[model samples]
Structure formats: structure tokens, C-alpha cells
Target: MQRRRLLPLLLAAALPLLGGPVAHAQAGRPIKLVVPYPPGGPLDAIARILAEKVQPTLGTVIVENRPGAGGNLGADAVAKAAPDGHSIVMGAVATHAINPWLYAKLPYDPVRDFAPITLVARVPNVLVLNVETADKLQIRSVADLVSYARKNPGRLNYGSGGNGSAGHLAGEMFKAQAKVSLVHIPYAGAAPAQLGLLGGQVDLNFDNLAAAAANIRAGKLKALAVTTAQRSAAMPELPTLAESGLPGLVVDTWFGLFAPARTPAESVQQLNAAFTAALNAPDVRERLAKFLAEPAPTSPAQFGDFVKAELAKYEKVVKASGVKLD
Candidate 1:
């Protein structure tokens, strides 16, 4: 009887140690960050940047590219993922904000389907025109572009990443604000849009600063103005749209990280902390600066608010632009 009592006590003593495996089970697994665009675009480039830096802190961050439907296809996957911390989408303005307004029926809700982590970075979209066209049209600044477009209404065409991309909305915003009639051309991605500008297929392209930085330096494309509240570091000499006579024409490509909805607040906090740290790292800052992107990290709650505000802001832009995708 004494031996049996001792055996029961030993079993009780082992229970705490046995809980280690159960705790490990609940510790979560590798996280998958889906990028809904093809490689080479600003979104994909930054996604890779975040992946390299964040994986070290996040245990295992697997970045998978799932490009389609102007970023909705991959984002849909993230929306349907389990509410654990195993999956997220490297969301951008196109995927998170503009798509909701452009598409009439979306498969997932931006606010309800995923939890915001942090805003990764923001890149100014620069107005780059074909060299020949810039010379022929006498377009040197935002005012010049507007005047020429207005003088030759419907003749000037502007290209964007896609129908619901930040570039498209920026152009639309420009149209509404400047009272100009430049035809909007939507490409599959920014790469194609860049090519269209170089090939003179499109009159101009509001492309990411990094993508067009090299071309601008080579004199292949003429950069009229950057579409940001402030000037871009890549080409500090270039003025902003607001400075070029169109005040309040600030449009930039903003990327953020998001986890599946219902992820524990603690986990979201941890992820945000890691991202914020990475953004502040000297190496990461330098790398972002090369692309003229500003590192922007914020608390999970703050990120959530930013997304909400962007959604509302873009909704009005989309309505004003009258861009509807079936």
C-alpha cells in the first residue's frame, strides 16, 4: 500500500514536466506570408526584404508568391487561413484598400478577414515619361503635364500597375484634381508599365521610384514629379506633385503585414515588435533608402487604424475615379 501511494505521488510529480510537449504544441508553427503579385514589382521586392529580415525573428517565415486578380487571389488565401499565427499576407494598397473599392464583389473583407501587424514601408510613385514624348510635349512638371494633357485632351495615356493599384488611383486623383483628361491604361504589373513607358506605348507611367530610378539616371525616361507629399531621396532634385502646382496630390505605395484574424493579441504584439526593430536596423534602413522607400513601423493597433483610414480614403478616390472592376 505504501508503494502504491508513492507511485501515485511520482505520477503527480511528472505531470508538470509532461506539459512541456503540450505547450510546444500550442507554440505555433512556421508563418507563411503571401504576396499577391509576381516577382520584380515593388510589393514583391519589399516582401522579399521583409522576409529576409523578419524570418530571423519570426522563427520560420515562408514567403510564397500567388499572383492573380490584381492581388485579390493570394489575399483570399490569407483570409481563409486559420486564425492562428501561421499565415499572413504582405498586403499593399492595391490588395488591401483599392481592390475593395474597385471590385464589386470581393471574396474577403479587408478589415474582418485579417489582423494588421505593422506598416512595412512606403515608396513614392514618380511620374516618368518617355524621353521623346517628354521633349515633344514640353512636360517638365506636374503643371506642364496637366497643361499639355488638357491642351490635347484624351491623347495622353497614363499607365499603372493595374486597375486598382495605387498608381491607377494616383492618376485618377490627378485627373480629378487637375481637371485633365488623360486616358488611364492598366497593365498586368509595374514592370510591364515601365516597359510600356520606355517603349513609348504609353505616354507616361507613375512608377515606383526604385523601378524608375535607374532609367531616370540613364536618361531613358524623364521624371517630371514624384507623387508624394515630400520629395524622394532617390531623386531629391525632383519636386513633388504638390510642389509642381497641384497641392495635396500625395499618393504613395504603402505595404503592411497582416496575420489571420483572431490571432492572440500577444502574438500580434510580438510580430509588430520584431518588424519595428527590423525597420529601425541600420542595414534595413539603408536597403530601403536605396529604393527611396521610407521604413514605417507602427503598433498593431496603429496599423489597424491606418488600414481603416486608407480604406475609407481610397473608397472616396475610387468613387471619384469611377473605376469599377467586374
Candidate 2:
């Protein structure tokens, strides 16, 4: 009888350890980091770099690409995933902030469907012209472009990645603020858009600094102004659109990490800590600087608030521009 009583006591002691917060935290498959865009892009590059850095703290981190519908496919997959903290999406301003307003039907709700982890980085979009075109037109700055556009309306044309892309919106904002008409030509992606600019198929392009940095250094493209509220640290010598003449023309693209809503708060906290640490690492900072991207890590709560504000801001811009996608 004493032996039976001891066996029951041991069973009771082990039951609590099997099914609890600690157990849940310790038991899981390798975490997967999803990049909505194709591999080799800025988002993919950042995700891979972070995955390598965070593996020691978070276990195996896998970066997967599921590009389609301008990042909705991969984002939707993560939103519908089990809330076990094994999956996350490398979301951007396009997916979370602008897509809601631009698309008529979205598979996932940016705020309700996911938990914000941390804001990874912010990339400024630079207004650049083909070096040959800039010299031919004698356009040295934003002021010069505005003057020429005003003088020869509809003569200058600009290209963007797509209809609802940040580049497109930036071009529209420039037109609205500068009071000049520059024909907009939408291309498949930034690469093709940059090619269009290079081949003289388009007069100019509002491209992400990362995409244009190499070309600018190669003397293929001339940057006029950065589309940010302040000058970018990657290129501190470059002026911002606000300082260039348009005081309120700021268009920055940001990337962040997100988990499905209802994920355990403990897991969320762990992820936030890991990613924030990776982003602040000296080597990571150095890598991101090559693309002119600034590392901006924020708390989960802070990132949530920032997303809300961006959604609201983009809503107004999209509506005013009357740009929508199915």
C-alpha cells in the first residue's frame, strides 16, 4: 500500500511539468520566417540575415518566399498559421499599411490577424533620373525638375514598380505638391523600372535607395532628393524632399516582423527580444548600411502604434489619389 501511494504522488508531481507555459515554450518545431517577396530583394536579404543571427536564441529559423499578389499570398499564409509561434512574416509598409487601402479584398487584416514583433528597418525612396537624362535636361535638383516640368508640362515622365507601390504614391505626392504633371508609367517591378530609366524609356523613377544606390555610385543614375522627413544616415549628404522644396513629401518604406494573432504573449516577447537584439548588432548594422537602410528596432507595442498611424496616413493618400487594385 505504501508503494502504491508513492507511485500516485510521483505521477501528480510530473503532470504539471508536461502541460504548462514552460513546456509549451520549450516544445516546438523550428521557427519559419516568411518573406512575401521573391528571394534576393531587400526584404529577403534582411530576413536571411536576421534568421542567421537569431538562430542561437530562437532555434532554427527558416526563410521562405511566397511571392504573389504583391505580398498578400505569403502574408496570408502566416496569418492563417497555427498560433504556436513557429511562423512569422517579414512584413513591409506595402503589405500592412498600403495594401488594405489599395486592394478591394484582402485575405488578412493587418492589425487583427497578426501580432507585431519589431520594426526592423526603414528604407528611404530616392528620386533619381538617368544620368544621361539629367545632364541632357539640365535638371540638377528637385527645384530644377519642378521648373522644367512647369515649363514643359507632360514632357517629363516617371516610372514606378506598379500601381499601388510606394514609388507610385511617391510620384503622385510629388505631382500634387510640386503642382506639375509628370506622366506615370507603371512597370512590373523595381528592376524593370530601373531598366526603363536606364534605357531612356522613362525620364525618371522614385526608387528605394537600396535599389538605386549602386547605380548612383556607378554614375548611371543621379539622385535628386530622398523621400524621407530627414536626411538618411546612409547618405547624409543627400537632401530630403522636405528640404528640397516640398516640405511635407515624406515616403519611407519600412519592414517589420509579425506573428499570427493569439500567439502566446511569452513567445511574442521572446521573438521581439531576439529580433531587436539582432537588429542592433554592429555587423548587422554595417550590412544594412550598404543599402542605405537604417536599422530601426522598436518594441512590439510601439510597432503596433506605428502601424496604426501608417494605415491611417496611407488611407488618406490612396483615397486622394484615387488609386485602387482588385
Candidate 3:
């Protein structure tokens, strides 16, 4: 009788050990989804949505904002964190592609220090002008804007989130490709940059579609063109910058999930599956559309290759723009 009782106790104690990887991941610790930008921005909003959607499959997921150094601070933290898959960063174009070339002495290697899990989404930047300013300048399209800028010769100024941000790079690319001169103004974040545009402090802005969608809808801002090769599904009426006379002006920003380089493949795969499922959920897709973002989940290997291509593409852009940060 004692032996039977002890056997039951032993089996009960051993059950947790035999529960397998998924069970272990669930019971061990909560997963941390680190956002490298401040809260209330599109990145933070997306991260929070993902955390909520994937929590069912991921057990317990939480978002932590560690905004600084143009998203490098949070990315570096993940790169150096324990490779146990409990911690991951929501890596963006700024962190992985632009920062590598922009910063002279980056604390971490974008390709070497992290493992790409799955790309969350891709959002194009829109060339948005203040509604009142657009009306005043009669800038109805990219062509009109370019002509005006050429005629004004540095009279028109554009605002961006920061120096090396996607918006800034887009403005530089536009200046080069369109052969126009517009003074560049860098703000603390996209929100402030948009504020500058709305308040007439800046004439125009190159902002993420998701960040500017609401304002565009409300007529506070006029989106002249999307900085992508193709038009966005959420706003199909908007034309692409290429179609608007600048052929090679594509600046679509992407966000993805990344873990430490040494994180187990199994763990990475599990994470990819969970995030992919969450991204594909009908409700999640609807929410992403509200922000003008498109779901673009990819396998780990595919995502890795995509990141490489992005880095290579941005290398040329950064070099041509002559942008570097100390």
C-alpha cells in the first residue's frame, strides 16, 4: 500500500518533466516582447496587439518598451539576453537595416547577434502634406510638389521622426530622385513630426502610413503618394511614389520578431508558429488594416533572407544619402 502511494506521488512529480517542450515553455516563465520605441506609436500599438493575440498560444506574453538610441537599446538588450527564448525584441527597419549603416559603432550586429523569427508586417511611408499647406501650395500630386520645390529652391521644408528614421531616409531619397531641394527637420518622434506638419511648423512629412492613416482620413493631412513599389490595400486610391514620377523611391518599413542568436531552433520555431497564427487571425488582420499595415508573416529562413536583402538595399541608400550617426 505504501509502495502504491509512493509510486503515485513519484508519477505526479515526474509529470511536469515529461510534459514536453510546449508545456515547459508554458510553465517556465512569461515571454517578454520588447518594443524599442516609446509607447503610443505604431510599433508599440502593434506589439501590444500581438502580445494579446498570441498569449493564448504563448502562455503569458508581455510587452516592455525600452525606447532609446533609435531602437538600438532594446535590440541590444535582446541580443545579449539569455538564449532561452523567453525574451525577444520587435525588430524594425531602423534597428536592423538603417541603424547598421547609420551608426558608426553599433553595439550589436544586426545579422550576427540575433535570429530572425518571423516578420510581423510591412507598412509603407506616405508623403503627407499639411491639408492647409497643400491647398495653399496647390500641391495636388508628387509632380506638383516637385515643381514647386524646384521653383522655391529650399523654401519648402520637410519633417521626419529623426535623422536616420525611415521618414528621413525617404525624404533624402525623394530629394535625390526628384531633383528638388527641401530643408530637412528632425523631430523626436513621428507624433511630434506630424504635429509639426499639422501646426504649419513644417510644410510636409514622410510618415508611416499606419501613423498617418487616421489624420489622412480626417482630412488633417493629405497623402500625396505612398513610398512603396505598389499601392497599399488599405488605401488603394493612394498612388505609389514611383507612379507619381519617381521610379525608384520605395521605402516600405517592416517589423519582425527576433531572439538571441544562440536561442534554440525549436524555441524559435515555436515562436514563429505562434506569431504567424496570431498575425493571420482574422481579427488581428482587421486591426492591422486600421493602421494601414499589412500582415506579412514568413518562415525563419525566409525572414532571415529578407533581412539580408533589406540590409543590402539600405546600404546603397545610406551611402548615397551620406547619412551617418556617431
Regions more than 4 Å wrong, model 1? 1-28, 40-42
Candidate 3 wrongly placed segments (more than 4 Å): 1-21, 25-27
Q: 1-326, model 2: which lDDT tens digit per residue?
A: 99989997786566444433333335656788999998988778888999999877777788999999989999999999999788999999999999999999999999999999999999999999988889998999999999999999999999999888898888888998999999999999888999999999999999999888888888899999899988988778889999998997889989999999999887788889889999999999998887677999999999999999999888988887798899
**lDDT score at residue 150, model 1, on the 0-100 scale:** 86
Clashing pairs in 3: none
Candidate 2 residue pairs in backbone clash: none
Query: How does model 3 score by TM-score?
Result: 0.88
Candidate 2 segments whose C-alpha is farther than 4 A from its true place: 1-25
lDDT scores of the candidates, listed in order: 0.83, 0.89, 0.89
Look at candidate 2 and tell me the lDDT of residue 239: 99
Model 1 C-alpha RMSD vs. true structure (Å) is 4.6
Candidate rank order under TM-score: 2, 3, 1
Worst 10 residues of 3 by lDDT: 15-24
Model 3 / residue 205 / CA error / Å: 1.1
Q: Candidate 1 — which pairs collide?
A: none
The CA lDDT at 217 in model 2 is: 81
Q: Superposing every Cα of model 3 onto the true structure, what RMSD results?
A: 3.7
User: How many pairs of residues collide in each model?
Assistant: 0, 0, 0
